[model samples]
Target chain A: MAPPEKIELKKQAQQLIEQYDNFLFDCDGVIWLDEKLIPGVLETIEHLESQGKRFAFVTNNSSKSRDTYIEKFHRLGFKGIGKHLIYPTCYAAASYLKEHLKVPAGAKVWVLGDHGIETELKELGYIPVGGSDPRLDDEFHPQHDLLKVDPDVRAVVVGSTKAFNYMRIATTLQYLLHENKSLPFIGTNIDRSYPGPEGLILPAGGSVVNYMSYTSNRDFIDVGKPSKRLLETILEQRDFDKSKTLMIGDTMYTDIKFGNDGQLGGESGGSLLVLSGGTKLKDLHHLIENPASLQDGPSLIPLKYIESFGHIIHLLSN
Target chain B: MAPPEKIELKKQAQQLIEQYDNFLFDCDGVIWLDEKLIPGVLETIEHLESQGKRFAFVTNNSSKSRDTYIEKFHRLGFKGIGKHLIYPTCYAAASYLKEHLKVPAGAKVWVLGDHGIETELKELGYIPVGGSDPRLDDEFHPQHDLLKVDPDVRAVVVGSTKAFNYMRIATTLQYLLHENKSLPFIGTNIDRSYPGPEGLILPAGGSVVNYMSYTSNRDFIDVGKPSKRLLETILEQRDFDKSKTLMIGDTMYTDIKFGNDGQLGGESGGSLLVLSGGTKLKDLHHLIENPASLQDGPSLIPLKYIESFGHIIHLLSN
Candidate 1:
């Protein structure tokens, strides 16, 4: 209930640096703003890698595939990070369906995102309908017939989409409402606002999923942070000591909540909040000043605070 | 709490007829299903006409203007009705704009319904946009551009639209979300299911309105039945006595609720729920038996009961 202690990254940060061997970084805000990298943050990741620290770029952006994100990593001067270390919400969805949902190959999944999700579904050998096809995706395409719920569509997956329209919403609602709504509804993530170019924030994946859920009067499965599915997928693929892993993010709700929930998977969890983008210190101060103003909001106070991920490199200097 | 008395309309109903002089009828299920007349109902209206009873047609359908509806009325063999006696939700919106919101002439109102709503807006001198325009309405139009919230758009009105798609919704949401959502959002109706030909029910005007409302996170003013705007328009245009007027409708929720709410305007309102369409006796029976299945639903029972309006001729036979 007390205000979280804010610590500068340079002062007495050796203990914080030595405490974590694995660093999970949230992209969009913490690592970069839009397509440009935050100053000194690339150096922070490289310096941490030189110290034998393992790191992964975690993102809820479902428009880009892991390979594309890996290309972005090199383009942004982030060194020693491979495609395998990049955990996007799209890949999280693919891995979740395969390993967790254990959806048999060739089973069809109705998609509601873009090319990123479609590519992931293909890689996992799951037949995907909707999402990318212009005939279905574009509202103006000819043969824009009313949707017939494909009995073959086993699950409905949602992500961020500029193309989400009435047809998509209606078709998806029919599936969820059919037979008293006994189908699996999955989401890439539920981030309310996606950071865009020139500091403009647009409606993200969560808005799409939430709109569908609200209209259908049904719930959904979100595979992105702060969902546990992304964290669980990372732990399943590697063997990192739980206590020595830190989830660093720009958001308290997603990244910090991800770390906290990960502890229930039977290990100590650590989280750090970087204040370079998205939520600012003034927003937290407003909440602190008026705690009872909101009934349900971010309740986690992350362990370490820094002006930006660039500031974290100072911790590695010692 | 007791079950309402189910009076077989034909078995002794002269007193029901004499209590009200103005009989407001809900079309679609009450008079005719689509193009064909609901058997014997035409004779019932004619018989009432001979007895000097007045009537009006109120519909939530926003696609058809009063003129179009009058054409349909004449096409259906109804001799006594005129365009002035018709009250559609589209008219309710126009009236609400002029009389309620007081939107000045030449002000722009963005529409999301069909030609009917646009026609009504034009008649009232409000510059209408979006609904029937090929530039913005057609999904295939060359400039399928992202919507910019036009500052001149004073209100956004929604109704039943087959053309309801992503473009319309996105444009409407931009207006509603602008300036922290300080716009008067109006809906033609909120009828969730529209009974189509061959006994099919499709998502109706309410679904389109609801979808936009859910995404925009803003409440809307429904100018259709269940809402008091339609009734208020009738009162403003006519000199009908409140106590002797009846709202005869097929569905209990909209029609019955309309009559009940009209009482707040200092009038004794009466309603009739026809069993020939929508909610059945069994549904009401289940609700009565359970008592807690829903917190708020159609709790109003009509003053008179009939198998269909066709059976009303039997009431006239006496």
Candidate 2:
């Protein structure tokens, strides 16, 4: 189709702002990176709050806990966002194991991840074990003898970790593969890489998952974004009306295509793409030229396009 | 599309033996795994030797050097095999940097592998730097700081490492991404996992290479088997008429598909799939039902079914 009409996008944003009561916004690239906020972000949030629009910061980065996000948001001048802010870590891990294996309450989980994954598994009534305490000076200490097969351990839930050891990972894979218990493997997300202060860092969680799957000779279930489970959880929590709800983000691979197919629940859906981060304008052109690249999911059609959140807010007001 | 008759394979092998005096055999599920030889292996070799056949063992496993393979083969009662046996580690490092980046001789290479890689890089005039010396009890010390970009460094060659550290890997990736003059990232092989005495172990070279690609936002050129360059090198060394030669192996993915038309430089090809190793008899039946899975590859046909080397020898002799 023709390039999305800007005028129509502005009109739709205006209508959505007037109608929707709650808005879920993605962090990382959407609002701020590290300590710096994206330009015009503060004003847009203030404007939305003035019009009584509720917003929650949702992120797929499981390295940090929700408390960490709250602290970071406040430090970056985003105040009033609470600890209940949505993150896919816990939900992803829970749904992942639950779907593939019979992980009942109190099932033992060997977790190699941060607080988000640890807390989520614990809350789900699963006995969480393993993983390193980041506070330790010798972070490389073998936290768990992953090679030693544990009959009680029902699953291995991998999230983000700074202390990724190849030997430990290999050992864990050995148990996961050879053990007759049929222990399932769960990956929080499959985002091959993540944006880091030093450009892009190896997202260890995905690598661990990749290693496990490759070694075990089986594929694990990814419960994070782009997989429909996280979105479904959000929709369930919000009781979102499918016909009217809109999913807004910058990446076509995750946000737009994910929202298009009612993966976020509900029968009808829409998406907004901002040319801000991750998937670039050139990528969009490439995708358009080769539609087959997107056969796994829906072709992206942004309901709105804006250079910054200020433009979105300005259009909403007008 | 009927399965190629056993008579056809015998005719093809006979032609190859007659035409080309030199033959190259791949080990690990090809000739033998641990101690036992593959079915029909000894008799086939005896028949070829009787016909004055010459062959060398070629393996992608760089964990053990040529001497190790020679020793292992000698123990397995394979007489007269020598050190000319080729492995991919050295060649992979040599050709990858030379062809892709034109890396000059004596440039420092951050080697994340064994002696095979180090020896090969040294041969190519690359000063193997980085990675820890296990004999010295050095705990994964990197040769250079990742934060300070080194312009003179040639490339990062990932091979198998006994001491695989995440921090070192992350740091190496950081240098490759931010510094190092956009050097070529090379992987010796892409076998995700390998069977070890303890069970399946993580193929660290493949893992590190994949992780670097993800973290550095770059794709690596793989040098081992199933890759076009390795296949071409093997074909060149053999000097066999491709139309007449038959590629036989138990693994359908790498061995059989390597000889298929879709593979790089795989113009003239024939393949025989055995039911002994990677691909099972059941899996072949499954693929036969789903023809789409076999597209862009050779026609996979069942060969003379045998359980052991003795059975294969008995059948072939008869």
Candidate 3:
């Protein structure tokens, strides 16, 4: 566990390009912050594309469907990014129901998120309920119809939503606690906060998921980043060798640990930290200083550090 | 060490009354379930009053102020229930700011709960903000003025609220994360759920507090039951001898642990669990069978068990 090597030299950037045949990118801080794209990120990705490096976009934000993300990517100047290349947690949750939990396509999936989850579930042939419902926007009442658990709901998916309220939480609790806590509880992510549009740190999807988990007094199946199942799915779907793949993102706990613990780069280590997003150089230094203070100490430590993934293009131009 | 003694016989009821000079009761389940009074509870309290026993009502609920509780008590058949004799967590939170944290009078306190916390803080010479404000009811927007923290607010108090929404949560998060999280963060209680009307269980104050804690990634000062500070304050305020007091509650984690950990009833052990609210007979059996399963296992186990606090009057009359 040496300190992460800073990718400042052009030689280092070239080595990074040659080190991996595939890349996994985290949205939000990594690719774009809100609606604004980071400088040179598009060029770096285009360079990778020109170099025949395979990649897919992975985001823990379950509020946007893959189709919505496609629009965002295209709007941000990303070209030829197909729906299959985007892996939002909304899609992961829906796919988890179908592939892992064996939930039938037509079964009802209770949602405590936004329209993204509802859209994904609908696209996957499952009926979505309790999400973005106008009724849940009403003030909480003891006898609200939604408070009663629908016997048809096969599982519960909790993610991020701007419409978080007591009605939704209380109703979701019924499903989570229904049948002696029998239903599968799926959480989209575990991110505490994210960089917001106004230079403000806003509560992220994990906070919402954790709130429900706390209220229900039960553990949830996290389908977001750092989850091995998600990593495995992405790797298998893209047909990329784990040893030759790299995870490039701004956050350490999710993206870095995801790459490191998944053995993404094999012995060379697969995770790279970028300062362009939520994490800064000081944050990396702090983690290196107090690695033992966190729960997953070593696994959270990234293999390398750089100013930003976009900095790679700047370095190559020099 | 052993199974809780069941207070069933008339002799047992009489002995219980003789054993304690003061009784601390948990209100939600022990006295009444919502607005409806638990059967025989008033008679039992009257019997204790006739025998010159003193008592105080303690509840984890922070939604209603002490004055509101007075109306509820009078609406039921209870007589002479004074405001000073109530120890709701709202009052505890306000008092903690004043006494423990040494926050100055007239200092602004940020609130993320209902009117109870605001009323209590205002009564204690503090200006309360952010709670029950109509603007917080608006849909969340990144550029909202409330997203900016007020430098004047000295602390943050979070508790239960049926009005919980993203606007309130997002606004409060600014205060909690303000000034490098330097402000004192006070949480009213830690009860996961309470028995609600219509035989339903509802999320409680702890869920809200925990949501903020998780979102902010900071711990809060819990001013509610099972906290030793709350017990000490009650004992000192009421001038009740620890050895002669009994804690009757519907919850094992909060009320029972409050009495047991505070060493109420001296070596005899102070807690008496009532199977009339949330905990059932089966729950107690499970706890007794597996003491090591919970975090605070031994302290949560009650010294005695009863059908209901009101059942004492029925037993004595027999």
Report chain B TM per candidate: 0.91, 0.76, 0.99
Provide interface RMSD per model, one decimal: 5.2, 5.0, 0.8
Q: Which ten residues in a row are the worst by lDDT in model 2 chain B? A: B302-311
What's the DockQ for every one of the candidates? 0.20, 0.30, 0.82
Q: Cα miss at B160, model 3 (Å)?
A: 0.8
Alpha-carbon local distance difference test for all models: 0.73, 0.60, 0.93
Please state the CAPRI-style docking class of candidate 3: high
**lDDT string, candidate 3, A1-318, tens digits:** 777898999999999999999999998888888999989899999999999999999999999999999999999999899999999999999999999999998999999998999999999899999998899988888898989889999999999998888888889999998999999999999998898889888989999999899888899999999899999999899898999999988888999989998999989998998887887787787888998889898888888888778999999999
Could you tell me the TM-score of chain B in model 3?
Answer: 0.99
Q: Rank the candidates by lDDT, best first.
A: 3, 1, 2
**Per-residue lDDT over B1-318 for candidate 1, one digit per residue giving the tens place of the 0 to 100 score:** 334545465554565667778878889888887787888888888877888988788998888999889888889898757888999889889889999898899999988889899999999998888887676545532134546667888988988786765566656666777776787999888776644455533456777777677666568998999886678678667667667787878766677667666652134347776777665777556656765555554345444456777776865565
Clashing residue pairs in candidate 2, if any?
A: B39-B308, B39-B309, B106-B125
In candidate 2, what are the lDDT values of residues B1-318, reduced to their tens digit? 554334334454444345445444557666775466666676677777777756655556655656666788788777877665455555656766776578888788876667777766777778876654443233333343443455666778776665556655665665566543276677776555554443334443566566666655577777765666776666666565554454555555555555553232134345555554445566666765766755633344433223322344454444
lDDT (Cα, 0-100) at A85 in candidate 1 = 88
lDDT of 3 by residue, B1-318 (tens): 877899999999999999999999999989999888999999999999999999999999999999999999999989899999999999999999999999999899999999999999999999999999999988888999999999999999999998888889889999998988999999999988888888888888899999999989899999999999999999999999999999999999999999999999999988999999998998899888898999788999999999899999999988
Clash tally, candidates in order: 1, 3, 0
